[model samples]
Target: MALKAPSFLADAMLGSVARKLRIFGFDTLYIAHAHDDEILKMGIDQGRAILTADKELFKRVVKAGARGVLVSGAGDLEDLVHILSKSGVTSVDLGGIGSRCSVCNGLLEEKNQEQLKNGVPGKVAEQHREFYQCMDCGKVYWEGGHLRRIRALAESVDAKLGRAVAT
Candidate 1:
């Protein structure tokens, strides 16, 4: 099924994976020190797929009728992609390419010219007209050289995963 929010609740052991999922534009919640019950409850309550390394926990959540996936035998990006593939995740939302915030999991909104004058540096304000600001954290995003690097990295990851790079 297509997820309503396309979000994941990753357990403490999968903190890095959760962060990378955010980088891939997926809304992921990472709680480094939560109990199993708390993790399962919030994940289910929020309609997020539970991603965990503990096989027993995975079984319990799955048996409870919660959508989940057991992550084991790997701890790298490639492994994460593979594990998530079972849940229908792909390269459609590459980092910074999609609307989700890279830092705060907030929806990014386009900032007007007037709003751009405040927090944005003078040089950046003059150089780029199109800018996006995070609704939750108030962090700004711009189309710059760094964005190109993100694009390149996304492309590389997609290519490595043998999937088409998102346009």
Candidate 2:
């Protein structure tokens, strides 16, 4: 059977991992100060898998009908990504790259230059021909150098896993 791309509700302690997952385009919810019970309840209610570093929390969440991953090491974002890939928990939809906001998890909508002519820096507006606006936060996104860097990183991760990029 094919694996589904699981949405995640990351516990308060796994903020970095949550951010990384978000960068990879997963719908990750990072609750930085949620109580363990609240996190478990939210995961169950939202049908979201839990990602956490607390073993006890993991056990409790599993009992509450929510799946979870108990991370063991710190400062190992790449390793966490690898683990998710190996577990069939991650899917790379490179085609939808930059479709989501990196900061607020909002969907990005295309914006014309005229609409942003006043808000963007003069040099940026003059140089870049395309722009996307975050529907939730109103932040603008462009096909900047950062996109290339992220794509390279995703490619490396895919290569390391010996898997073809998802369509």
Candidate 3:
């Protein structure tokens, strides 16, 4: 049987990490308002590994026989590297083709420029030929400076993983 890619349930404190994970095409559920018990229950029920910075919550997760990762990194970059490493992702997929919506964890579907209608500013539509819309939230995305930064971070992650960055 083929191994499934790891999915995650991140706690309120790890929103940034969750967004980065979604950007990297991982399935992540960010529970910002749920109680610890609710988060734990959802994580186990959905078969998602819990990502948390709370020591007590991690302990509870382990005690309940749920898979969990204790994230205590200095920043999102470090936490992301650690999480990806733990999930056995040796290389990052820097291509934005399969990325999820950072805001809602929804799948992104590529859309033609004309299909965007009033979703994007006129200047953005004129400059960028490619576009993606969140299938769940309808948020529009295009290649921009943020994408460059994500690529650079992916390169750094690649180097740290001892893998050559894919062009």
> Highest TM-score: which candidate?
3
Task: Report the CA-based lDDT of candidate 1 relative to the real structure.
Answer: 0.74
**Model 2: per-residue Cα lDDT at residue 143:** 79
Q: Which candidate achieves the best lDDT against the true structure?
A: 3
Model 1, stretches more than 4 Å misplaced? 1-5, 72-76, 94-96, 160-167
Q: Which stretches of candidate 3 lie over 4 Å from their true place?
A: 96-98, 163-167
Provide TM-scores for the models: 0.74, 0.81, 0.91
lDDT of 1 at 37: 90
Question: lDDT tens digits, residues 1-167, model 2?
Answer: 15566778877777766765666777778898878989888888988878877889988977876777777656544655555764575445666567777777777788989987666888888888989888898989887888887777666666655552353
Q: Give all candidates' CA lDDT scores.
A: 0.74, 0.73, 0.85
lDDT of 1 by residue, 37-156 (tens): 998899889998988889999988988898888888475555566655666655445634647676667878888769867878888888889888888998888889877865675676
Off by over 4 Å in 2: 1-4, 73-80, 86-91, 163-167
As a TM-score, model 1 comes out at 0.74
Better of 1 and 2 by TM-score: 2
Q: lDDT per residue, candidate 3, 134-159, as tens digits?
A: 99999998899987777787778767
> Cα lDDT of model 3 overall?
0.85
Locate the minimum summed-lDDT window of 10 residues in model 2: 158-167
